[model samples]
Target chain A: MHGQPRPYWNPLVAGLILGLALLATFLVTGHGLGASGLSARLTAALGSWILPEATAANAYLGGYVKAGAPLAGWITWEVLGVVLGGLIGSLTSRRFRPKVEGGPRLTPARRLTYAFVGGALVGFGARLARGCTSGLGLSGSATLAVAGFVFLIAFFAAGFLTMRLARGAWT
Target chain B: MSFPFYDSGFWPALALGVLFGLALEGAGFASARKLTAQFTLRDFSVFKVMFTAVIVAATGLWLAEELGLMAPRSVFIPTLYAWAIAVGGALIGAGFAIGGYCPGTSAVGLASGRWDALVFIVGMIAGAAVFAWGFDAISPLYWAAPGPKGQTLDQLLGLPVPAILVAMIAVAAGGFWLGSRLERRFGGPIGSSDVTCGSEGAQPPETGTRPGSMRPS
Candidate 1:
């Protein structure tokens, strides 16, 4: 049972905290945030377990396979912390309700389908770029990496253009 | 000037990860609606937070190096892979438009107990598997268009760090100004479903409680 939920923090305020968090990560870990790498590692590990011969021969998955344990990297541990933090934030703020979130117009099945399809595209793209929004989009751009800016523009442009598709069924 | 403390181990990683998560959840990113609102022009929180965070981080990073408090190149710098990221980021964007959740946000959404977020994660894993399967074909493009390692925008443009950063700030300010106008025009904050729920994990569903100012009827 969820109680009254608090409003979200103002964007700038939250952004400050986020920036500090990222800065703290750099000062402490010599790197920035990441998310998609975990998926890659997981997939590679699963492949290694399920089809060792074939997976190990894979050009990308093999690199991960040879890279030792999937969870050995620092990003994995950080991402675990992120998951825990999310739960803690939700519980404390009374925002922790277990439900499939979709707008009124969307059916649960359709939302879930959208989620899966979208997630797949994001996963593939993030891996191709060697990072996702948090990884390359935020961290890289902050460091002024040229690819980061390039990624930023490309990502947002594509998103705005295709957003109508997402809401098409809703209308 | 590497910081020896960073070598201490996973404790920092774990602790920092928690902080990152708290910031994201606290920012109201745990909900898919909040994320997608920016795309719809109903809410600009994503753009606001993104620009501010990146600017602050870039400034902080530069200051730390300037003050010699942080090690030179202590943080990981993203490499330049022009085509790979160009193509890949577009895909990610398209996915975001459709899914309304990125990899990190999906994690937060999952923590909030959304089944869709879980499905998203599963899809992500499957998608990664697809990339792994086709790595041979993709590897050529992925490896192509390599730029110098650790190339900064300042270096690329032959400008000082401060100049580039300041210019970015100006650009962001302009974008922010424009974004506010867009929000005003759209008339929205398109509240998510069950933004205000009763005592139940699964609240009764409906069209969002607060529709945007000009949502297509």
Candidate 2:
């Protein structure tokens, strides 16, 4: 218990490290890190394999099917890498634990429900905006993209505003 | 212009993305409690990591672009589409507050052995599917209120990349300074759980300890 895990790195230091990583990606791959798009592609592919007709007929998903193996897409692979990388990081950092994180009094089921609903909303919202936090907020701002700033402000503002509604999650 | 693998291949890109993801998770971002502390004005972790990354990348890209090693255009930035951005940002924020994870973080959490992360990922995929099916009806909104696309700060304000990059670094520096002060005033490390225990890991600081709760640490 003495070493349940470690403290997080310095915020400024961590941010600088991430910033340089993004820069490296731009220099090397000419793109930034992304996760949502890849997941979308995978979803489309799985949908296609399970329900080919439906996937092909769906307006948004059909494009991905027509484009070929969705899993082969760049973002898809990158997202996979994200999962793998995360697992490795947790393992190395000694933070790998199987548990449901929620408010002190919240049940696992309630936490799961909120997680699903929140995730769906995030997905839909990310699609509408053309990206999510990492893609729009971080990568976007790194390039000084105006949309990046807008999304960042909006994201934080809404989070704070809606935070009260979910007070049970905190003390 | 002389970088060997501007288009090296899929493996490298994937590897780099994985490294980035690992870095984010390793920094304690995989936990929603950690990320949301930013808005609660409790912890400065998110701001610290995000701003630092921006500064580092901005400076690196600026220097590379200046030296002609990189053509910034290769990186993609979406068009403004104000309504979409606003609506989407709100939804994402709601998700963050409710689920304590983002698209990137949900994936990280899933990897880190959280069942909720899996649920979130599945929901995200389903949500994406729903959006895709409704794309035709939403097409207009997707491109509404179009702002600049892939427009960098240097290009927009007619400032040199170096100058703009330097300005960004300065802003981050200022933010860091303020964040530290807020943490001190806030009573704990900005985002640590209030019910502190000397458990397995080093827990984050508790919230509402600050004089003014909305200090934006």
Candidate 3:
């Protein structure tokens, strides 16, 4: 139901555009971009709804709940926009074919499993670091924050090492 | 209007998020294989895009502050937790290598109809829940070391802001130059063929198909 996929924009060009967006965000909002916070907030909110006692008693989830309504928070709205933007881009570019994407070495199930585990690790890691790529890697580092650079270096080094070990997953 | 307009300016934040997502998808980051290619040194889009964005945004922020266009301390600086952040970052990196999509790109991939990305998002939520439950164990280290919120790189390195900026710019430019060279030598060819999302026989693009490279040619 789609035509051939379009070629992606050049990396530098895309980066420049993205950088402008980040700058605009900083100029207007006085905060850098973020993504993983959404997951933490949602988890906190949903957990409290399902197990108010347990969630509130839990140190991490409890703090998130006290912060504000999860759905109405700043990053929540931003992430909603992220989904919408990607949807629009995919639709216009004709790249919206729904399927399990993976390297030649894996089956759909395997790919999905790896994706889930990887996502889980990132989720926990982001929470621990108090931010993710957009927050710590880009925004934090952009501000020249010490923590931001630490995260960037640590994550890249760990990622390369893990990728080497899991060569079978993609190679 | 005012700086740090989170309460009064959610609309703007949402708009910026869209632009961010669009840029990532346009860069082919909606594709997991395309993203993971960075680890293999087969593609450098991730490095190129990230550093470019950093350099541009950081420089712009510095200039704006200097010009008094934006109020100082308007931007929220993350607090420093040395041990927790380092360990957390390592975990995140391992996750990135395995998952291919980070939180933002996973959302983009899901938007583009990738079920794997959806699963990954779900996994993230579950992981967060686990972290919550395990907070007691991690809390000690999480709170072990803390720095003032405005712990910028210049302060950390004992270098002035301008010097750090200059260093960052040079490093990013050099990385881009090096990345292209690596891609030329070790990278898998970017595909011009029709991308198939088929089952069993389908392969993600730009993954090595050679003895150890990208997709089937």
Candidate 4:
């Protein structure tokens, strides 16, 4: 592991740790994990910065302003920790490198374009659904929530179909 | 009653998020190639890891509730909004396949200096802005779908928690077994391939190649 990056953890083991973390969060905070909510708040904050009156007038963006600073929420701090933790993990494993991730079939430009489109869709969808993979899928499912199971089924169905349609970009 | 430590704010949440990120990165979920491989049927690492985590957390939480260590009602439950959730799921699923990273994983990827992850993050914020901007127009359709608020699987099926837990465990176990077989057939061992893009003309070694063989000759 000196020159080369260390191999990733076994999936099962890493998953166990993740599960423990989830349990711990539930026990302590009386809530589960989330990602997209922070993104929404960030968006609201940005909107408020650009157009204070219009953003504050909007029902969704206005909520953040009413709640005070959008960035001063628990999820926002947790996301910041996520970035810090990821940096630590990557650095310790010697996997930190500036580059894009894509298959040989696609160029960096094309891959970035796809990434942006995908991210936008995720952002839009997460808001509509009220959560994301972490918030709705994992946390909600663990609690046996109906919405979680539904999201899981629908997510996989769309994912498989989309993957087939976009084969050239990946394969 | 004394265990939750709720009076202590932010620190616990932050610590848990860190651990969550670490587990994801260490499991190689931060890599778009590895994640997309799940959709391509080339690898099932994502499925295996996620199912395992779900089972572990579900079982543990149930046990804690049984022993009166915690109250189930205290946990935040997402309300059911049928059509919105389903459509949202479809959008997210398609995004995952195209972008190759989910919200949590993309953060890890960005932290590790993946340039594409940055672009994806920007896109996500923009998308959120778009949604906020169009909230009034979409809200009618979003709320039109009929569903019970905060319904659970056990409640929907009128099943006992123990029975549901058992069924979930079985399903997860079966999924893992099937995922392992799929990976064995369509893909190589986990983490055997490096997916970081290099200079133009550099091809990532084919799957199943020896780990060190990705280097240019």
Question: lDDT of all predictions, in order shown?
Answer: 0.82, 0.74, 0.82, 0.82
Error of 4 at B37 (Å): 0.7
Residue pair clashes in candidate 3:
A144-B153, B207-B214, B207-B215, B208-B213, B208-B214, B209-B214
Candidate 4 backbone clash number: 0
Off by over 4 Å in 2: A1-3, B190-217
Q: DockQ values for all predictions?
A: 0.69, 0.60, 0.73, 0.71
Count the clashes in each prediction. Answer: 1, 16, 6, 0
1 against 2, candidate with superior DockQ: 1
- TM-score for each of the candidates: 0.93, 0.89, 0.93, 0.94
Q: Best by DockQ, which number?
A: 3
Ranking by TM-score: 4, 1, 3, 2
Tens digits of per-residue lDDT for model 2, B1-217:
5542456367877787787777788677777666666666566777778878877876776677668875646566656889998888888988888777889888888887777788888889888878887888998888788766566666668987778777877877898788877766654453322322323222334445566554432
lDDT of 4 by residue, A2-95 (tens): 2467888888998899899888888888777888888899898988899989989998789998888888988987888788889999888887
In Å, residue B180's CA in model 1 sits off its true spot by: 2.7
Worst 10 residues of 1 chain A by lDDT: A162-171
- Per-residue lDDT tens digits of candidate 1, residues B63-114? 9888888866767898888899999999999998888789999998888777
Q: Please tell me which model should have the higher TM-score, number 2 or number 4.
A: 4
